[model samples]
Target: MGSTEEERPEGLLGWCLVANVARETLHGDSGLDLQHGTKHFSADALLWIPPIPWDPGHWRWPAVGRHRGNSRRYINMVVRAEDLENFRVKGVYSEALVRSLNGHRHDPAAPRTLQNPWSREQAQSWADRWNQPREPVRIDGRSHPLLSVPNPPPAELRVNGETLHLAHYGTRGAHYSRNPPPTEQP
Candidate 1:
């Protein structure tokens, strides 16, 4: 950000966690390490709080995933060491696991998955672009009311248990079509 100012934020720090969780990257026990619920890990001196993706109005599981009308529910969250919460167990946590996810703070829109690996960099930029106090994303022109939920990146990242599986991913022209065979992520 110091040198690349105009195209990005004024003080953009490139070292940010990227907050990435693509199914391909989270495959195996790796996904298990990054469970759906919030976690209090140290990405360095900065505390990391990976909040579970959820809803505000009815306090239900918010939809998430790549394709249209499809959604994946997360099950964990993390907070900074100084954050006001603690992990009491280690299993499939229920709704009660997250008492104050600030549901009053999340109105997430399942943004479309980034269509390219280069866009992975674009999606990473949102770490700084959307981190500030702002409104959540909008789908079909409607925004979630909470306005604090960190919307999913404009890319689909699926994780089975603790593993990221590239079931089938690629670009448009050469993508895996339902008719024949499933391909791979590029």
Candidate 2:
């Protein structure tokens, strides 16, 4: 769906963690099945956990705990193609509900640098935090949950700093193209 009025989509639109979560610390005591299945989630992939924050926009990207508890590295949340419809319909959250998701994208406790505000060590641990594309995903009609979810095993994504598409990943750490991108000639 990376088309623009029948044209192609332009701009580096991917996803970002608009809010920070403290699920491990807050719900560590609770017996919640927080561990996303490995088959479902790749190392440094994304996710769309429940108890969502109220937003006019669907819950987009959330930093997945790569090191778990360490909060250093993370991936984005993935969702089913069917679920996107449910999120945009939800909006407005109470302050108490949103408090669980309060914090800086990076640790505000540390000093701010022009590039990576955190110190070198801090930055290294949370390196994936900086992997975000410069732009946010543009809502075209509606975004399918599968397209939005992290670790999209059933699908793959492509971003050319101007467009993104969903398709089979012919290669790992590859580039972006139209969904169902042309297969690599292995």
Provide the clashing-pair count of each candidate structure: 28, 20
1-186: candidate 2 lDDT, tens digit per residue:
634434322331211222223222111332233443333343333332323333324433332323334444344443322111111111213222122223233333422211112232443333343333221222232324223333333233343453455433321222333444577897
The numbered model that scores best in TM-score is: 2
Cα miss at 73, model 2 (Å)? 21
Model 1: weakest 10-residue lDDT segment is 169-178
Candidate 1: tens digits of C-alpha lDDT, residues 70-114: 223332333222112221112112232122222344323412211
Candidate 1 lDDT for residue 138: 31
Window of ten residues with lowest summed lDDT in model 2: 83-92
Cα TM-score per model: 0.17, 0.18
Root-mean-square deviation per candidate = 20.8, 18.1
Model 2 global lDDT (CA atoms, 0 to 1): 0.30
